[model samples]
Target: TVIRNAWAGDPYPIDTLMMYMSNMAWNSSMNTVETIAMLTDKDEAGAYKIPFIIYSDAYYSETVPFADLVLPDTTYLERHDCISLLDRPISHADGAADAIRHPVVQPDRDVRPFQSVLIELGARLGLPCFVNEDGSATYRDYADYIVNHQRTPGIGPLAGWRGKDGGSIGKGDVNPDQLQRYIDNGGFWHHDFSDDQRYYKMGNRAYLDFAVEMGFIPCAEPIVFQLYSEPIQRFRLAARGHGKVQPPDAERGRIEAYMD
Candidate 1:
């Protein structure tokens, strides 16, 4: 839909699309030819009529030539990454978890991790959190941000042993050697909950409290499962000409039919 709107110049919200390790061919899992054609569409002036695509991928693929700008990225073994609860965390039914990927070998090519490029771009753009009051870059690189940028006073992306001696967990002062601690501990962290806190995690009181402390939930409270959603109701009201938040006419039918 975004590509179609952009190609048609229908006042689409996006002027540019920055994709990282995304397969445009597999997006929406259907309409591959249409998606690619719309993305590569040109105006009468021979410029891209659709959103200007900036793509990053570690390897060459079928989607590369269509991008206006292509950033070469390093393999996973050549970069640092954090899988945090704030994003798509790696966890099991027994516990909430997070992990890191530290570079084991240096890349011989002129490529960097896509994340590093994004951090550099953020600093260049002077993004609020990525820049200091004096306009200096807040972090030197992705690894620096992983170690120093606190989500709160002390907590950061990693949930492993924190603080000076690498002894604390959950919340603590930032440890300069935190990444080394993780590397020493085999490049991942796992916190297993007590047996009483395992089952019915979403609604369980004990589990909820643990989740909050580990930066999973905003607060420890029973998570009520919604059957009929309020947003669906809002969309329905908007369709009836009754609310501020209204979906476009083309989207109204789908919004009105939302069940889950």
Candidate 2:
């Protein structure tokens, strides 16, 4: 229902939205609203008033009917992706881990990985990060970006084999054959923490140190998990006319009630 939430109010707020690997029919709340809006709405210029929706899916699904553009994405086995610490990394408390999906077979249809498409689109839009000084595309594709784009000066999205020779792990120079390294290592890479570094991760100095090495956090600072959030309290205070940012009149009551 995030798409519908983005489409809330009399005039739709978003200009463009791309759905990746999502089933809109499964969207219990947003599907009907999105369908009605997309089919019937028009702008002052006689163009479709609703946000231009681009739905992407590997299989032919019920959501295809609503898309202005249907970008056919390849199956997972036919694409390259990295499960990095940035998103939901498949890591256990014992170790920081990441994995890669290497295309096992060629796609028979005109399909591409969404990550490659996004990179190309970013280049087309001339986004500074995705373009060179001469306005050429920085990285050729998602795999190229994975190998070259450093999250920090030396650290990147992948924690696996890195460095000029593909011999190092964690922090190192970009390895051109880094993807190959992952492929060779059974499609995954892991860094196991020591016995003392396994539990009490939020406060354990050793665990925090390893987390920093793996780019999980900036520093090995102990984290205090919040039970009552100050940000929520701020929203409540705003509802009572006490802050620069104020809640809408309709939402004020709900916000204030949640504060207590």
Candidate 3:
């Protein structure tokens, strides 16, 4: 969608493209030659279709040469990262788990961690939640943000050893030494489900309660599977010009053919 939008400029044109660790010009793309051509494509006025690009990567990959500006990044051994539960967690069928990666060796180069750079950039841009009440930077670095930033009242990126004294789990106040605690406990946290809660989880009362407690769900309601989707019906209606936000005439046939 981004590539198409960049070239077509339909709906609106984007000013800049920022990418991190994504090698779109090479192995990541289905057609690398075509992708490279698109990235370097020019308009009739001799202007680039995609104006500016900023890319960051630890290694000088194939995509780096196409970027207008490149930010050097530290490798895994010299960076901190979180395999957060709030994102893509490392989970088993019977358990929920998360992990972290702390720098084992310092970088010999002048490169910085991509995440830390993003945090500083967010602060400098004065984005909401990245700034304090007085408009100062909220976090000193990515580590500080990871340990303190809460998505909700108690839920954070990690889910273990929470609270002031680091005795709580699933949900609690922020623990200042949470990273150290994770380091001490082998860099990962796991929570096992009871036998009853492990099976038939969608409707299991125990599982539902556990999910709510773990901030995985808003309430302990049984998850009812939908046999018919009204949202799809609405899109079909839009395709038939029955709504304000109707699909373009070019897309109407495709929508009607596939939506049902």
Native-referenced Cα lDDT, model 3: 0.89
Alpha-carbon runs more than 4 Å astray in model 2: 9-12, 27-51, 248-254, 257-260
lDDT (Cα, 0-100) at 247 in candidate 2? 67
Of the two candidates 1 and 2, the one with more favorable TM-score, higher being better, is 1
Query: Per-residue CA lDDT of candidate 1, range 74-152, in tens?
Result: 8889999998756798878886677889998999989988888898899999998999999998988899989888888
Off by over 4 Å in 3: 248-260
Q: How many backbone clashes does every candidate have?
A: 0, 0, 0
**What's the candidate order when arranged by decreasing lDDT?**
3, 2, 1
Pick by lDDT: which candidate is best? 3
Please list the Cα RMSD from the true structure of every candidate, rounded to 1 decimal place.
Answer: 2.4, 3.0, 1.8
User: Judged by TM-score, which candidate is best?
Assistant: 3
Q: Poorest 10 consecutive residues of model 2 by lDDT?
A: 3-12
- Best first by TM-score, ranked: 3, 1, 2
